[model samples]
Target: MTFLLLVLAIASEVTATVSLKLSEGFTKLVPSIIVVAGYGGAFFFLSQTLKRGMSIGVAYGVWSAIGVAAVATIGALFLDESLTAVQMGGIVLVIVGVLALELGAAH
Candidate 1:
């Protein structure tokens, strides 16, 4: 359950971040609303996951890394942003680091 909540939080955060770019410095109304609500809900669920058994450092690290990667991917795919090879490699590294942290926490 905690893991599920963490995943949801990560997804919500990613969505919020992507929508933020669309908000155009808050000049746009609808995307701005999504950004606000999405972040609020994401944090609420993240807090709940922390209250469960997940360590703060681990949970936050994983959530942030995943959120960044997801947001970058969305930007590249939907916004037609170019993701250079180096950027893709960096994202892979972030995923690997998160996996390493999860494995370390398991033991």
Candidate 2:
């Protein structure tokens, strides 16, 4: 359940980040609203996960890493953004680092 909440938080954060690009420096009203609401939902769910006893370090590390990768993928797939091989390698490194953190926390 806590992990689910964390995943929701990461998803909401990534959505908001994508919406931020669409907001055009807040000129667009609808995307701006989505940015605000999405971030709010993300933080709220993140707090819930923390309250449910997930460690702040592990949860935040995973959340940020996954969120970055997800948003980058979204941009590449839907927004016609360039995702170079180097960036893909970096994303893989981030995932590996997160896995290391999770594994370390298990001890």
Candidate 3:
């Protein structure tokens, strides 16, 4: 299903972004490879989902927004990155935007 593929694309993109940090500036071979492959698969599947009827603008907006949020969370949890209150509020806004986009696409 297109929805499932879209979800996979978002997940793969998030995984790839997290792996990018683990890649250590691409010095670590394995993590670097994971980043490359994960992003490749994500885009490939996203293309398929688009072909399956989802609007490109809506799909890309949701994907990028969710990917950014997930990667930020991963950085906070695993990399011990500090998220200021303002940054946290920004992430919440991104989520709200994604939800609004999805709702608009439903009509």
Give me the candidate number with maximum TM-score. 2
lDDT of each: 0.91, 0.95, 0.89
Residue 3, model 3: lDDT of: 85
- Candidate 1, which ten residues in sequence have the lowest lDDT sum? 64-73
Sort all candidates by lDDT, best to worst.
2, 1, 3
Ten-residue stretch with the least lDDT total in model 3:
65-74
Q: lDDT of candidate 2?
A: 0.95
Q: lDDT per residue, candidate 2, 1-107, as tens digits?
A: 99999999998999899999999999999999999999999999999999999998899999999998999999999999999999999999998998899999999
lDDT of 1 by residue, 1-107 (tens): 99999999998898889889999999999999999999998999899999998998789989988888888888898999989999999999988888888899989
Off by over 4 Å in 1: none
Pick by lDDT: which candidate is best? 2
TM-score of 1: 0.94
TM-score to native of every candidate shown: 0.94, 0.97, 0.91
Indicate the TM-score of model 3: 0.91
Residues 26-100 of candidate 3: C-alpha lDDT, one tens digit per residue = 999999999999999899989999999999878898898888878887888889998889998998898788788
Between 2 and 3, whose TM-score is larger?
Answer: 2
